[model samples]
Target: MFSLPIIALLVAGAQAAVLTLQSPRFTVSSSTGSQLRSEPISLAHASSIPVTLTKDDVLKLTFQVIDKESGKGVQPHQTFLRFYDQNSGEEGIQPIRVTNGGKAKFELNMARPPLSLPPTSDAPLQVSLLIGSSTYSPLALSLFDLIVPASHPVPAHPDEASFHPLPEIHHTFRPEQKLPPRPISALACIAVLAPWIVLLGLWGQVAPRAVHLFSPGIFPFILTLGAFESLLVWYWVDLKLGQVLSYGGVLALVTIFTGKQALSKIGDRRVGRK
Candidate 1:
């Protein structure tokens, strides 16, 4: 007796050998009337034709399947159509099953309206199709070139009285609309340096003995101020909060090191005095 797995494999092989895909045919229609009734064309030898269509136009594609040995129509259980636009990189998939006649049909609506083109220019709307299935291999069809026609000019009214000149509009910049100067101000520079100067004075006056031992002088204060001002300038010019915070962290580390050195010098002096 055959095992269940063996039986399943045999059934799948039989199904694969029997099912065969045929060439697809299509028809195009617009608001005016039917445009084309294409003959069955093989997927390999399929050619693209430049087709001009309006937003109201519709295209219907028909895919047929048949038995390879018997040459009879075979209804597919399920079918999937993938339509892709090459230029826009847009894609859409539609699921449609075959009918009794082994024909699966789907309609494509042209929603993108046509634009005006120069006399020597042609804008190609490139599109392609793919038919996929779980049992059979995917079928890739040839590209389709679609063209949208420019809009027609509206006719002027026959009555001269109905026509009037449009109102005149002025396009001029006013004084109030002018942009403010972007240069950094002197007041801002003073504000950033003022705090450092005040701290240095306090350290000298309030702790005169300690200042003599741990006198870092103006060099450290100037270096730290310069670094902080550079960060401030970068923040103002680039307006990057992340860079400001990163540079600020580095400045914090520098300040901490300077403070520790001053404290150590003062501690050493106290021990010496003791």
Candidate 2:
């Protein structure tokens, strides 16, 4: 058995070996079995004539990966075929399977295009082969330019428009409503308060007797109810409706409690007199 250092050196030397392809060739055929083109691929340069395929045509490629010095077939760790649409800036990589003996074959049928194919345009796709291995150096070869029928445009989603930024809202709000002249505003305010003012002016003539008006229990009920009214007035002038409602709810509870106590006291006093 070799020593550890010697074995490591041998493995490193083996991994540094160069890799190449053997008998790289492609054949284009019709669905009806008639061959349109058949030629061996050159690793030095890509083909000048682009291979064209119609709706039902098929393309078959055959190649074998080998060690450059040993000339023996090698099954690499990874192999891939890349199709790139130069104009569309779209590309796709399709993994290729190499047999244990390093024999590899790929077939492209236009009848059912592979998902790895990029959406194509009028421009030809630049085809390339890439192979990687742990034992040998990686290799890349530009194959041939391929021209196929343009793919149908991808359909848009139903909510595609919702994805885009919305147009800015330029609210055309009514210019701040100008207030009426001060004298007119004052007159309007007076008009609104006119009935109350008149009613207050005639209070002495129409005022009725309220014997329990100042009774301690009854007066508290009246004061709580009055506070409720004041809360409403505040809402009309400065406070928001929600705040007024919240305050009114609390005031209503206080008013109910006071009214109940006043009624209870009156009943007890009446019972005492009877």
RMSD of each: 23.1, 12.8
Alpha-carbon shift of residue 241 in model 1 (angstroms): 42
Off by over 4 Å in 1: 1-15, 18-23, 36-39, 111-129, 146-274
Q: How far is 230's C-alpha from truth in model 1 (Å)?
A: 43
Per-model TM against the reference = 0.38, 0.53
lDDT of 1 by residue, 1-274 (tens): 5569888877776676455556676667876676754555455654566655666787667767766677677665556554444544444455666877766776666554212221111355444455444655445556456565433433457774347776688988666865445455666777889999989988988865533532564346456767888889978988589878878998979867766665676677779962
Candidate with top TM-score is 2
Q: What residue runs in model 2 are displaced by over 4 Å at the alpha carbon?
A: 1-15, 156-274
Indicate the worst ten consecutive residues by lDDT in candidate 2.
1-10
| TM-score of model 2 (CA atoms) | 0.53
